[model samples]
Target: MPRRIVIVGHGMVGARFVEEVRRHDPAGERASLTVFGAESHPAYNRVLLSTVVAGGLTAASIGLHDPDWATRRRVTLRTGVAVTAIDRPARRVLLADGTSEPYDELVLATGSRAWVPPTDGLLAEDGALADGVATFRDLDDCARILELGRPGGRVAVLGGGLLGLEAARGLVGRGVRVTVLHPHPHLMERQLDPGASGVLAAALGKLGVDVRLNVMAKRWTPELGLECDDGTTLSVDAVVVSAGVRPETDLADDAGIAVDRGILVDDRMGTSDDRVHAIGDCARHPGTVSGLVQPGFEQAEVLAGLLTGADPAARYLGTPLVTRLKARDIDLAAVGDPLVEPGAEWADASVEVLRFEDPFRGRYAKIVLRHDRLVGAIMLGVPDAAASVIQLFDSGAPVPSDRLALLLGRALPGEATSAGGPVGSPALLPSGALICRCNTVSKGALLTAWRAGATDVAALSKVTRAGTGCGSCQSAVSGICDWLAAAEPAELGEGAA
Candidate 1:
């Protein structure tokens, strides 16, 4: 008999786990699967919700699976239903509809929920969002926000984090007057240093996003708009809250499972109970620095391998830290820990700090190296440098000796040439260099897929999921497509496929 694997929460990571499991046990000879989604609709790309808020893409365009995907895979998928309880002793899942399903193994991918701050009047008596207040969490939030944020409307976005800034830019793009109220002194304090944060705030200001720093939302009422602790009231039609998120660990907590800030897991992503495991935002691993989709995707792969018995020795060490802000008119990528101080004991004698700022040009670059390795960096307004720096950072290879050129994005490793070619040019990246961090697609992988007849960007995305996550790597994929099309059919490495 096949091992019964039941999954909870059908967010991006949950759906990905399903796909990864199918890859190993395509014929279902080893494992049978069932997935439960709390949301009524099928899983869509949550990373691209910011773009949906920006109006560049529709809700229908970010779907991860087709209508008959489950049927074709011979898997059971239940959507718009809640898994209320996990009967651990019975090895079954109890649903809210008074039904239960048995499983030999339980995978938790519950993800997270938008963290709404305790601003007065923001929540109704029934604990729902008060009128004129919404979050930028899901597509449903996007629809409501777009309907209320009509052109000429005034909206107050509470928070200056990545999500807030994206929503603010989107609202401003739609001709809605936007004001970003951040409680912290700078935006994205966790990802960016003060210098980089300053440049980012200035760029947002130039883009018509009024950013207010070092201020907290004292109270929020539809009639009075938002009242600040600085004794000011900003009258607006709506409020979009993007403070942060808290992992959805209620199910794990309710069951007799271990949970900290998230569900605690070991190297194998197994919970305290060997039969129960967790991944994604809901699962807390040692090496995850931030709550991006990449780590979750990596975890899903590790769990799928172990569950299917394809690799009994497979273990999930951790995911490297790399975050990209998917906002228009601004290019930003943060790798490792860019906030390391020069005077800190660990960084004192060994670390080499370098920074170059050009606020007039809206550019800021900072790199912190220790022992000839690219340890940390914050690249802003420099897409070329970001592309190459991210490559060097991920490879853990020695950076080029010419620090200035590397900072300016004019230098690269020996294998790749940078002679006037765009930093995003496929020729300038080593074959193994990652072009898309979302699906972990590499330049070599794209070439292999192209040689195999997935020639265009859309086809490439369909086959390899290169530009599917946040759509940040769409241009890079397009550049690869153009280069492949212009070159001879068998120019170089045509047999890679």
Candidate 2:
């Protein structure tokens, strides 16, 4: 008999676990899976919610599964069902509907929730969102913000992190005047240096966003807008909070599971109870920065292999930090340890740092190297440089001895870059070179999937998930598809150049 597996939470990581399980146990000979979701709708891509707010995509367009997906895969999927408690002794989960489901193995994927700052009037007396206030977390929040945002109205975005910045950009794109409130010296302090942050703020300012740094919201007045700690009040139509998120771990703690910051898991994603496993934002693996989808997706794959007995040796160590701000007219990617102190910030003479800042043109490029290998980078408004730098970073290949050439998206003599890339042509990249940092998709994977009938960008994304994560690699994936089509014009059955 197949091992019975019950999964809680139907967010991105949870849905991915289901797919990974089916991939390993294709014939269902290893595991019988049942998934429960608190939300009424099926899984959708939450990363693209900002795009939806910008009118670039409809809310209906980001569905991860079709209506018959669960039925076709022979998996029991219960939506709009909340698991209120985990009955560990009985090895069953109690549902809010007063029902219970026994499980031989349990997986928790309850992702994080949007954190609303404790500003006055942001929350109602009952602790729900107050009127004229919204959050940028889920689909419902997206709709609420859209309703409150008018073409000429003003909106205040709290926080200046990736999601917060994305929300500000989206709202501005909708013709709403937007102000970004960040309680830090610079934006994206985790991923960018002060210089890069200044350049980014300038770029956003040019795009009509008003950015205020080191500012805190004192309160939100529904009738008068937001009051800041600076003793100034801005009249806005709505306040969208993207302060941050806390992992959803109430159920795990209630069930006597070990949790610190999140449900604690080992390298194998097993919690204190060997029968219970955890992944996604709700679970904390040692040395991983949570609240990102990439880590969770990788964890799901690793856990799936172990549970399905497909790859018994699979273990998730950690995901290298990669941050991308997906906003209009903004192209930025911070990879690896970009937080490493720059010139004066550190006394390490062994580190080699290179920087090029063109604030006028809204471009900044910084590369950190040690032992002749690329370690980290910050690239904004330089897509070409980003592609080359990321490839070198992922492959641990030594960068060009001429740091100037590498920073400007140029190659040394006798390079393939004449075809318009620092690394020459996309075809010349090492097969192991990573193309999509968010999805961890490699060039070789794209080639294989393309040969298997995924000829265009959309098809390749569907087959290999190249352009789905942060969407920063969409252009790169499209370029690879074009190159493949041009390289083998006859082999592409359809959608060929």
Candidate 3:
């Protein structure tokens, strides 16, 4: 008899876990899967919700599964069903619909919920969102914002973080007058330094967003708009809160699972109970950080390997995260620890920092190297530099001696030069080099899919699962396809020549 696996949640990470499991257990001789999702819709890309808000993509465009996907995979998928309680002794999970399902193994992928801070009049007496107030976290929130965010209307966004900035930019594109209220002194303080934040703020200003920093919301009402802690108020048509998110751990806590800020898991993604595992944003491994989709996808792969018995010794160390701001007209990418504001006494002696800032042009680049290895980087308004820095960081390559040239996107020594300039060829990238961070897809995997007759970008994406996560690597994937098309004939004629 095959092991019966029950998975809770159907978000991006959960869906990826399912795909990975099916990939390894195609015959279904080892395990049978069942999934329970609270949301009514199938799994979709949450990373592209900002794009949907910007009118670049519809909700249907981000879907991950077809209607018959579960059926064809021999998996039982129950949408709009919440797993309320777990009866460990009975080895069953109780659903909100008064049903139960037995499981030999259970996986938790409940993900996280957007956090709303304590502000007056933000919620009703029944704990429902007040009129004209919404949190930008999921597809439902996107739809609500679209309904309320009218052109020529005023919208107040609370928070200056990545999501908040994305929402603000999308609303601005829709012709809404946007005012971003942030409690922090600078935008994206975690990913960007003060100097880069200043440049980003200037760029936002050019996008027609009014930024009010170092202020918190005192209260909010549909009639009176948002009142700040500084005793000031601004009228607006709607309020969208992108404050942050908290991992959904209530079910795990109630079920006696070890949990900190999120569900605690070991290197194998196993919880306190060996049969119960956790992944995605809800799982808090010692080495892994939450909120990014890359880490969650990595965790899913590790867990899938163990569960499918394909690689029982598989262990998840952690993910080296790369952060990108997906706002329109704003190009920015940050990798590893952007050692911003290091102590002056130890800064110069410990790490070499290379920085180039042009506030007038809204461009800033900073690269932090430790012991001659690329450790961290931040690039804005420099796509070429960003691509090179990310590749170097990903591959653990040595930094070139011409630091200024590298910072300016010039050709590194020993690299082939082209008429277009020093942009490295896609063919030079190692097969293992990651091209899609969101899905953890590598260049070699893409090439393998292409060699298998998946020639076009869309077909390659469907086959290798590349360029599907945040859609940030779509251009890179297209470039690789173009490169492959040009190189194929040359390779075939090598023996003849």
The model with the greatest TM-score is: 1
Per-candidate TM vs. native?
A: 0.96, 0.94, 0.95
TM-score (C-alpha, index-matched) for candidate 1: 0.96
Whole-model Cα lDDT of every candidate shown, in order: 0.86, 0.86, 0.86
Which digits, one per residue and each the tens of the lDDT, describe model 1 over residues 187-260?
99999988999999999899999999998899988887789999999999999999998988999999979999
* Global lDDT of model 1: 0.86
- Weakest 10 consecutive residues, lDDT, candidate 3? 414-423
Q: Tell me the spans in candidate 1 whose CA falls farther than 4 Å from its real position.
A: 413-425, 494-497
Residue pair clashes in candidate 2: 416-424, 417-424
Q: Model 3, 1-497: lDDT tens per residue?
A: 88899999999999999889999998788889999999998999999999999999999989998889998888899989999999988999999989999999999999999999989988989998989999998899999999889999999999999999999999999999999999998999889988899999999999899998999999888887889999999999889999999999988899998989999999999999888999999999988688888888889999999998998999999888788889889988888888544665546666888899998998999998877777888888877778778878877878878889788776354332221113246656666767877776777777778778999999999997777877788878887778777775654232311
RMSD of each: 2.3, 3.3, 2.9
For each of the candidates, give the backbone clash count: 1, 2, 0
Quickly count the clashes in candidate 1.
1
lDDT (Cα, tens digit) per residue for candidate 2, span 34-72 = 999999879998988999999999999988888999987
